[model samples]
Target: MTAAIWTDGVPVQGLGLMRLTDDGWGDSDRDPATLVQVALDEGVTLLDTAEMYGNEDIVGRALGSHRDQITLCSKFGVYRGDSGRHDDWYVRADPATVRTAVDGSLGRLGVDHLDLYYLHHRSEETPIEETVEAMAELKQAGKIRALGLSNVTLEDIRRAHAVHPIAAVQEQWSLTQRGVEDYLPTLAELGIALVAHSPMGHGVLNQNADGELAHELSRIASELGVGAGQVALAWVHQCARQTQGTVIPLPGTSSVSHLRANVAASRIELGDVDIRRLTAAV
Candidate 1:
C-alpha cells in the first residue's frame, strides 16, 4: 500500500512518542529531540503522540522546523485528571470537547493543522455519529486533514465512516495481543489503515518476553541475526502484506539506538516458515 493512501505520504513504519513521557517506558530522561531526529533521519516519519501522553509539548519542541517532514498525529477525548494518574482516566467526545481538545493539541504541537487526528476512544455517553460529525467539521475547516479512530469497535468504524472517511484505526496488536486482529478484515474492506500501537506487546515480545513466545522469538531472531523486537515488527508488516492493507507499527522508544533498530525492522523480511512458527508460538 502506498503511504499516501492512508498516512499522508509518510512511511508505513512509524514512531510512537508515548515512551518519551515520564508516565511509562523508563526512558523519560533521554532527550526527546535526539530521538525525533534519529527517527526522521531513518525515514520513520509517522510520529504518533497523544494528549494523554503528557509529552506533546516535548514532541512539539523536538519538531523544531521539521513539522513538514513528518506526519504530525495526535489523539484526544481520552483524558485524565490533572493528577496525571491513569486511574483517573475518562472519555469525552461531546462536540464542545472535541473542538476544545483539537485547539489545545494544536497549540501544544505548534502546528496549524494536524495531518491526522484521532478520537482516542469512543465516549460511552456521546453518540459516535455526533463525535464524528464534529471531527468532519474539523476536516472541512482544515484544522485536520484526515480523521482516525483508536480503540474503537468495528461497529464504531462503520458508523463513523458513514459520517466521514476514517483514514486509519490505531489499536494494540502484536503476537501476544491479537484482539485487534478481529477487525483487520473490516479495516481492509474499508481501505482504512491499521496503526499497530504497542506492536511489541508492551515489551512482552521483547527481551522481557517469557515462556514459549520468548523462546520462539529468540530462535527466530538468532537465525535472522536481529532482535526479537524486530521479529515482532516484521510480523506486523507481514500482517499488513497478507491483507494487502497498510499496517504501520508505531513502536515507541526514547533511546536512539532502539529507535534506529525499530526503524530498521521495517526492512526485515521474515520467511513463510518463520512467520508461521511465530504465529503458532503466540
Candidate 2:
C-alpha cells in the first residue's frame, strides 16, 4: 500500500483536534458519527489527535477498524488538564514514559497501533537522541507504524533522524505562520514530509489576521471568490508543494461545511500572479 505524503509510511488524512472543543460551531463536530461520515464522504482519510485532546474516545469509537483504511496521526509530549490547557507538560524522552503514554493512547483510541506518532514538542528536558530511541522501540514493537517529531529545530531533527527515520514533522506553518520556512530546506534534504498543522494561522488569515495577514487574505479571498480561510490555506499548500514535500493542513472546525471548505483549498490552485501577490505581501 502507498503511504500518504504526510504520514511517512502511513496512509490517511490528518484531523487536528486542538480546537474541536464543545463549541457549537455546527452539528457535525458535536456528534462523532456525523464527523466520521462527513470526512469519509469527502475522502479525508487521515485523522489526527493527541492525548491532550480528551476526544480519543470519540475517535476510537468513530474509527472502528475503518481506521485500517484511514490514516490517523497523533502526537505526545504535552499533558492536558480537565480544561485542556498545557499545565504539567513533560518533555521526557524516557522509554518508560513513552511506553505508558502509548498504552494510554491505544486504550483511549481503541486501536492497536497508531499509523503515525510524533513527539508533540521538543525542549531541553530530553535530548532528541533519547526521544528517537524510545520512538524506534515503539515502532519496532508495533505501537506505531512510523515516527515523527514536532516543534523541533533542524539540528534536533537531524539528530532524531540519525536515530530513526522520522516520517513527518508537525509544525505550526501557514501563510500566516511561516516560521517553518527557515528550516524547510533541511526537511527537503532529509526526505521527510512536512505536516503544516495550522495553515490558516489558527483561523487568523481567514478570520482575523491582525494587519498583514488581514490584507493579504482579503485580497486573495476576493480573487478566489472562496473565503479568506480558503485562500490562506491554498497559499500554504502551494509553498509546501514548492518545498517538494506534501502539505497536510489540518484546519479543524465543528461544522462539516467548513471542513469541506478546508478540503476544497487543496483543489483550488492559485495562479502565479495570485501566489506572487500573497507570497510577497506576507
Query: lDDT: which candidate is best?
Result: 1
Compose the digit string of candidate 2's lDDT tens values, residues 32-84. Answer: 65666678788777788887677777777766657766777777877644564
Worst lDDT run of 10 residues, candidate 1, spans: 21-30
lDDT values for all models: 0.84, 0.75
Residue 267 of candidate 1: its Cα lDDT? 83
Query: Least accurate stretch of 10 residues (summed lDDT) in model 2?
Result: 4-13
Model 1 clash pairs? Answer: none
> What tens-digit string does per-residue lDDT give for candidate 1 at 1-282?
345433446376888888675333234446677777778778888888998887888789888888888888999998777787769888999999889999999999888999889999988999999999999999899999889999899999999999888999999988888898889889888988899998888876778887887988899899989999889988887776787566778888777888878877888899898889888987
Off by over 4 Å in 1: 1-10, 22-29, 82-84
Give per-candidate clash totals: 0, 7
Once superposed on the true structure, which residue ranges of model 2 sit more than 4 Å away at CA? 1-13, 21-29, 80-90
Clashes of 1: 0
Residue 259 C-alpha lDDT in model 1: 82
Pairs of residues at least 3 apart in sequence or in different chains that clash in candidate 2: 12-46, 12-71, 13-45, 13-46, 13-47, 14-46, 15-48
